[model samples]
Target: MDVLIVGAGPTGLTLGIDLARRGVEALVVERAGELFPGSRGKGIQPRTQEVFDDLGVLDAVLAASGPYPHRMIWKEGERLGEEPLFEAAAPDEGAPYTEPRMIPQWRTQEILYARLVELGGRVAFGRGVTGLTQDADGVCVEFADGTTVRARYVVAADGGRSVVRRALGVGMTGEAVDPAPFVVADVRVRGLDRNHWHAFPQDDGSALALCPLAGTDEFQLAARLPQGAAPDLSLDGVRKLVAAYSHLGAEDVTQMRWASDFRPRAALADRFRAGRVFLAGDAAHVHSPAGGQGLNTSVQDAYNLGWKLGAVLRDGARQTLLGTYEEERRANAGAMLELSTGVHRGAVRRGGATVQLGLGYRESSLSVETRTAPDGLRAGDRAPDGTVAGVRLFDAFRGPHWTLLGAATAPAAGIRALPSAPGSYGPGVFLVRPDGYVGWAGETADGLGAYLARVGL
Candidate 1:
C-alpha cells in the first residue's frame, strides 16, 4: 500500500478521503470495533468547516449541526441570566462561516466515514498494532492479531496515548492544565430545556452544567470534581450529579448514553515525523478542551499532511516535500496549545482565535515572496474566498489541485489558473497550494515554475 493510517478518527478519515480522491492507495485501520460514540470534541471551528466544505461534507455537517446556544445561568432553582456561549463573529465576504458549529464527535466520524467510503477508501476495524519498524523503502506494522501491513508511509492518528507514538520511543512533554478532575457525559434529562445551556456554579470552586446537544435530544453534562476523585459515569451517579448541582431531582435523570473522565492537560510530541511514520492529531499534540482547538487543530494536521503525501506518492514530487509537514504544523500546534490553556484558565476569550480562521504558514519554507512591495495578500497566507474574473476562488480551489490567481498568458503548469484575482487577494500573481495557502506570490508569474518544481508537480 502507498499509505497506512493507524486510526479511523477524524484526522485519519479526513486524510483517507483526501488521499483516496487523489488516487493514492491508502488504508485507515482502527483498533476499536466501531466509531467513537461520545459527544466529545463537539465544536467545529470555522476553519475546519471550510475544510469540510472542500472535502464535500460541509452540507451534511450543516444539516446535522447548529450554532452554539446561549448559556442560561441558574442558582438554587432560579434563572439568573443568559449570555452568549462564545464570543460572536460576523460573516464577511471573505469568510462565510465565522461562528463555531455544534456536532457530536460520533456524528462527525459517521459523516467522514461515509465520505471516505464513497471515495472507495477502505478502513479495517479491530486491527490493533503491537509495534512497527521502518526501513528505507517502507514501514512494516505488526498488529496484535498476528498480522503485518506494510506501506510506503505510516501515520499515527491513534490518539494522544498513541500506541504507534510510544512504540517509536517518541517522548511527549506536557503539564496538567488543571489539577482538578473533570467529567464529561451525554445523558437524557427531563427537567432541562433544550434551548439554552443551564449552568450552576457552586461557591466551593466546583461547577456543573447541562448543555443541550444540538440536533439531538440528549444534553452534554459536564462537571468539575475534586482532585483525585474518581468520575462516576453510572446512570445513578449522573442522576445524583445533576440533582446536586441544580434544582433538578435525581428522578429527572432518565438515561446515560456515553461518558468519559479527563484531566485537562496540554502536551506536545517531541517530533511529528520519525522516519516513515508521521504523527498527526492527538498523537502529535494534546490540548485542553477549552476554546475547542484540539480537534480543529488535529483535523488540519491531516489536511496539511494529506496533500504533501499525495504530491510525493502520486504527483512525483520530491520526498523532501514531506518534511514541511512537521515544519508547518508543529509550530501551529504549539501556539494552539497555549491558546487552549489560556482559554481553560479563563485568561482568553473564545470566538476570534478559537474560530481558527486566521492561522497560516507564512514562515514555512514552501512560501516564497518575490514581490518587493507586496500588498494585501502575501505568500503563506490563507487564500480567502471571493469572486475573481467571474470565478469563485473557493469553488475553483475545491479539489486536489493547485490554483493560480493570475493571467494564463502562456503555457503554464496544470494548475487551475484564473485570469484575475479578487481585490481581497490584492493585485499580485498568486500560486495557491492544494491545502489553500498561497505558496508563491509576485508581481508577475516569473518564478512560478521553480516553486512548482519544489511542490513535486
Candidate 2:
C-alpha cells in the first residue's frame, strides 16, 4: 500500500477520504472491531466545516448535526439563566460557517468513513498495529495478530494512547490542564428541555453539564469530579452522579449508552514525522475538550498532510515536500494546545480564535509571498469563499488541484484562474493550495510559474 493509516478515528478516516479522492492507494486499519461509539469531541469548528465541504461530506454532516444551543444554568431546581455557550458571529462571504456545529465524534467518523468507501477506499477493523519499523524507502507495520503490512508511508492516528507513537519512541510533553477528573457519557434522560445545555454549578468548585446532543435522542452528560475522585462508568453510577449534581432524581437518567472519563490535559508530540512514519490526530497532540479544539485540530492535521502525501506518492512531486507538513502543523498544533488549555482554565472564551478560520502557514517554506505590498489575503492565508465570475471560489478549489484566483486572464499554464473577486480578495493573484491556503500571491503571474514548478503544480 502507498499509505497505512493506523487508526479509524476522525483523523485516519479523513486522511483516507482525502487520499482516496486523490487516487492514492491507502488503507485505514482499526484496532477495534467497529467504529468508536462515543460522543467525545462533539464540536465541529467552522474551519473543519470547510474541510468537510472540500471532502464532499458537508451535507451529510449537516444533516447529522445541529447548531450549539444556549447553555441553561440551573440551581436547586430553578432555572437561573440561559447563556450562549459560544460567542456568536455572523457569517460573511469570507467565512461561511461562523458558529460551531454540534455532532458527536462517532457520527463524524461514520460520515468520513462512508465518504472514503464511496471513493473506493477500504478500512480493515480488528487489525491493531503493534509496532512499526521504517527504512529509507518505506515502513513495515506489524499487527498484534502476527500479521504484517508494508507501506510507502505510515501515519499514527491511533489516538492519545497511540501504540504506534509508543513504538516510534516519540515523547509527548504535556501537563494536566485540570487536576479534577471529568466523566462524559451519552444517556437518555428526562426532566430537561432539549433546547438548552443544562449546567449545574456546585459550591465545591465542581460542576455538571448535560448538553442535548444535536441530531440524536441522547444528551451528553459531563461532570467534574473532586480531586482524587474516581469516575463512575456504570449506568447506576451515572444516575447517582446526575442526582448528586443536579435537581433531577437518579431515576431521571433512563439509560447510559456510553461512558468514559479523563482528566483534562494538553500535550503535543515532540515531532510529527519520524522518517517514513508520521503521527497525526490525537497521536500527535492531545488537548482539553475545552473550546472543542482536539478533534478539529486532529482533522485539520490530516487535511494538511493528506495533499502533501498525495503530491509526493501519487503526483511524483519531490519527497522533500513532505517535510513542510511537520514544520507547518507542529506550530499550529502548539498554538491550539495553548488555546485549549486557556479555555479549560476559563481564561479564554469560545469565540473567533476558537473558530480556527484565521489559522494559516504564513511562515512556512512553501508560502511564497512574491508581492511585497500585498494587502488583504497573502501567502499562507486561508483562501476565502466568494463568488468570482459567477463561480464560487471554494468550488474552484474543491478538487486536488491548485487554484489561481483574482487573475484577469488565465496563465498559459494549466492552473485554474478565477475572475478577480475584488470585494473579498482585493486585487492580486492568489495561488490557493489544494488544502485551501494560499501558497503564493503576487500582483500577477509574474512569479507564479516558479512557485507552481516548486510545488509540482
Candidate 3:
C-alpha cells in the first residue's frame, strides 16, 4: 500500500477516497466489521461541502439525504425564537450553503466508504492496528490478526485513543471540560414537534439540545446528565430524560433506537507527524462536540493533507510539503478547539449556538500575500460567501479557491476558471481551488509570475 490509514471513520475514508481519486494507492483498516450507524455530528459546513464537491462525492451525499431542511435550534423546547444558528444573516448571500444539511455520522461513513470503494480502494474491517514501526524508507503496520503490511506513509485517523499515535509515542495533552461523563442518545421520540429543537434545563446543572432529523418527525436530543449519573441504556432512561427535561406531562415518547455515553475532553497532540507516521482526525485533536465541527475538521485535515501528499509522491515535490500539513491543519484544529470550547462554555453560561465558523489562515505558505489590509480577510483565510460575487458558484458553496474576478486580463497559470463571469469577480484572477481557496490570485498576465516568484510556484 502506498498509504495505510488506521481507521475508516469519516476522515480516513475521506482521505482514502481522495487519494484513490488522485491515483494514489491506499488502504483503510477499521476495527469494526461495518460502519457505525448513528448520528454523531449533524451539521456539515459550507467549506467542507466544497471539498466533497472537489472529490465528486457531494452528489452522492445529497442523494442519500433528500430534502433535509437546515437545522433549526430552539430555547426551552420552543421553536419561534431568534434566528437559528445557521439561518443568521451574513454579508454574503451565497457564502454559506443555500441550506446546511444534516446527516448522521454513520450515514456519512457509508457514503465515504462507498465512494472509496468506487475509487479502487477498499476498507478491511475487523482489522485493528496493534503495532507499528516506521523508518526513513517506509512503515511496517501490524494488525491484531498478526498480519503485517508495508506502506510508505501511515495516517492515524482513529479516534482519540489512537493505537498508532500511542505507538509513535505522541503525547496528547489537554484539559477535560466536563470531568463527569454525559450520555448521548439518538432515539426516535414520538409526539414531539416536527419543527424546532427542544431543550430542557435541569435543576441539577445539566441541559439538553434536541436537533431534528430531516424527513423524520423523530428528533435527536443531546442532554447532559448530572455529574456521575449512570443511567441504564434502556428505553426507560430515554423516556425519563425526555419527560424530566421537557416536563411534558402527556406525550408518549418511546422507541429508543441507539444510546451511548461520551466524555467531553479537549486535547491536541504536540505534533501531527513523526517519521512516516502521520496523525489526523480525532487522533490529532479532540474537543467537545459543541458546534458539530469535529468530524468536519478532521475530514478537512485529510483534504488538506491528501493533495499535498499526492503532490510529493507523484510530482516529487519537496518532502517539506508534508511539513505544511501540520503547520496549516494544526493551526486550524487549534482554532476549532478554541471555538468549540467557547461554545461549550457558553452552553453552560447561556444556552445558544455561540460558536461561529470564521477561521482564516491567511498567514499560511499556501496563500499569496497581497495588498489587502492586515485586518481584512486574506486569500488563505476562510473566504466570505455572498451575492455580491454575482454567481452562486462563488457564494462559498464550493469552498474558497483561487478566485480571480475582474475585467482586465492578467497572465495566470496553474489556475482553474470557475463557471462564473470571466474576470468579473476579479479581472486578473483566473481560478480558485474547490475549497474557495485561492491557489494563485492576481491578474492573469503578471499574477502567475508574481505568485510563482513568491512561493516558487
Cα error of candidate 1 at position 378, Å: 1.2
Each prediction's TM-score versus the true structure:
0.98, 0.98, 0.83
Once fitted onto the true fold, the runs of candidate 2 whose alpha carbons sit more than 4 angstroms away are 408-414
lDDT (10s digit) by residue, model 2, range 249-331: 99999998899999989999999999999999999999999999999999999999999999888787888899999999999
lDDT at residue 281 of model 3 (Cα atoms): 97
The TM-score ranking, best first, is: 1, 2, 3
Model 1, runs deviating above 4 Å: 409-413
lDDT of 1 by residue, 199-262 (tens): 9998887889888888789899999986767788888888888888889999988888899899
lDDT of 3: 0.69
